[model samples]
Target: MISAPLTRRAIFAQAWPIMLGQTTVPLVGLVDTAVIGRTGDATALAGVALGTVVINMIFWTFGFLRMGMTGMTAQAEGAGDAREVEAMLLRGVVAGVGLGVVLFALQIVLIPLALETMAGGGALDDAARGYVSARFLGAPASLAIFAINGWLFGRGRTRAALALQIVMNLVNIALNLLFVWHFHMGARGVGLGTACAEWISLAVGLAIAGRGVDWGRILSPALFGGGALRRLFAVNADIMIRTIALLSLFLWFTNAGARLGATALAANYVLMQFVSVSAFVLDGFAFTAESRVGQAIGAGSRSAMVRAIRLTGEFSLLAGIGFALLFFVLGPALIAFFASNPAVRAQAGAMLPFAAIIPAIGVPAWLLDGIFIGATRGRALRNAAILATALYIATDLLFRPFGESGIWWAFMASYLYRAVSLGAYLPGLLRTIEVAEPANGP
Candidate 1:
């Protein structure tokens, strides 16, 4: 078995690299916007923005590949199943690339449908369509990279994962500048540049992931047998459902903000940046929990598993409190940084208290998600998401009379529901290690 010390220092070692990697993610979007905006072409900028939303929405549907790959591979690593570890990556890559191809093939139908819902017709539509068309070409690479990154994370190769992210972002940024500034390809260039960067990153990722891998084990028929594929797909499907349900809650939140008025919508948008920032930072601890907990489960060490959860949870808790304090102290300045409109700034400031405490309130839910994901408890996750979402919507409606503040309260309520609902499954999760095999293994 893979015996690694489970300690707070180990948790920090795992988390910092992930946090650094996540920090670069938002930079890519900023670069995309900056390169496009320099031309002073509002239509092109808006098109690129809308196209990004559409592409992200589509790609997110298959995010299960990344999460599932990490869980399965981590478990295999914990079990000291060298063969299974390699096989997990192989299966993940195949499924990722295969699903990406399907998405590309259906781009004609998918792009326009997504655009119609998200954008108006004419030049804007055409610009968005152009951007999406070019970006869609890299769908396979993008998805494949997801699997590769997942594998790296599972192996606790956080430095490699960090390098992979930095390479992709830097390459994308450089190419975007070259395409927009030098070639004048507008939104199409932006999309193409990102697509090309993804492909290049995939090449690098493969070289890294393939190092010392046992091809014989990965290519074995037993590894790709019907039973294995079924198990992988089952976990993936459940995670997908869970992801979609969670996304719907946010989408509804955004829609609700819109109904409140343009000011509220804009304010909420700015406020969401706070939530996003916190999530990005907190994900480091959550991801650490994933690998550590997965290894603990795989080794069937209940104490290790409990230690993993407690340690990671503690770090996340402290980080969340830190964020809350920072937001409360610098709330206005940060609000000003994100918003220029006095009205928007004022509204966002009014709502800042709600956003400020979210990281703290939401920590348990986020940490629990990582714990369950590591355990491969997909059914528990799926059920909790559905129930939590339903309660969120019900609470939102119930709080309708309070307006925007009520919505924020309901949003907070969703996090609580998710934690409580999933928390209910902890006993069963712990009991699994007492058995011969994990109850929820893929």
Candidate 2:
């Protein structure tokens, strides 16, 4: 019986918890910016902002644990392979923890290189170092949580995922207040709080996962054998490279803003927050795409995957539009809330329209990303990213004479290109799958 693949109720059931969970993430950043900005020190603010970006680059690069795990595990789940799901979780957690160890070991060299690339050093460098060093403490725990979260999402345990995230973020915020406000610990305090929160969340996730699986059955020598290992590495490596390329573009954006100096950097930093918040919202639907699409494939239901994609993509689009409108209406107030420095505020206010336009353009790009991840379409993603990034660089150069607005234009255009590029490829990919089935029935 071919029917609608997903209902609005089904989509909402999946999306709402993810959205609510994600909402708390920005609160941590907002709190950090508000508390640190209140210190009336632009240099410190810029350092923390820059530090945050660097930390994200390092951590997010390993985001393959979450993404790769989610797709694989969700498919296994839909196929009713409980043992495979367990192995997937174990593999992700193992890889994540190992990568975290490597990151911590390499941070000393990595931090300096990242800083110099941004032309960051001096007063700004000192504060950023303080912040990043503190964050480094939780690398292992943070990655562990990534693996844990991915597994939870794969199982369609959205509410549990939501609870874990909310607890983690709340812990971060509380500690941020204690250290930065009361103890006057500065940027280091912010980092430490975030680190501690990550470890705490990992503990909670482990407890939940423990209740669901027989660990003795989940572990096996074959888990690391030729076929399974090769698949894991191949999938994760693709996603990792894709992630690195994407992060590089954003890092380059921040670096460009840095060359414009502290005020511009700070302003750009705050504006990116709006972008992040919008992403978080749309990501709710993206996640749904990952779960539902993977599940449908595992169950051999092409119609289900098609239906899930349509519903989730539409939901993401609507959510994105809402973000754009919110930014347009309240851009200034939010900018003001983030920065007390007059110059930073002024610069950010001028760029407000660009910020407002991001979600609208980002809607399709983000939706496609989720779709791709669900289908495990890494090569396509990598190709699109390469093409989009090349164009983005060229666009940035072409608009250089116009200064920051030019940069903003280039940024906006790059996202549009990403969407158009991915959106174009998606239909062809779907057709192949659709054609693989009988004209009338599966």
- Global lDDT scores for all candidate models: 0.82, 0.84
Q: For candidate 2, lDDT tens digit of each residue in 1-442? A: 2112378897889889998998888878888888888788888888888999899888998888888888888888877898898888777777778889999999989988877877676989998999998999899989988888888877778888999999999999999989999999898889999999998888888887667687898677787775886797698787887888788888878877888998888898889889888888778899888888777767767777888888987888888888999999999988888788899999999999998989988988898888888777778888888788888888988999999998899999989878887787787667644323356854
Candidate 1 lDDT (Cα, whole model)? 0.82
Cα RMSDs of all predictions?
4.1, 2.2
Off by over 4 Å in 1: 30-53, 115-134, 176-193, 258-267, 334-350, 400-406, 435-442
TM per prediction: 0.86, 0.95
Which candidate comes out best when scored by lDDT? 2
The number of the candidate with the highest TM-score is 2
Itemize residue pairs with steric clashes in candidate 2.
none
lDDT of 1 by residue, 1-442 (tens): 4446887787889889988887677667656655655455656765675576677778877877888878888888888998888888888888889989999999989987886665245786787788999999999999999899878878888888888888998998898889888998898999999999999998998888888998965787787796897888887788888988887787667667756654676577567767777887788888888888888778877878888899998999999999999889998986665555677778889999999999898999999988888888889989999999999999999999999999899998999999999999999888878534456732
* Candidate 1 pairs with clashing backbones: none
Q: Distance from true position, residue 33, model 2, in Å?
A: 1.0
What lDDT score is found at residue 236 in candidate 1? 77
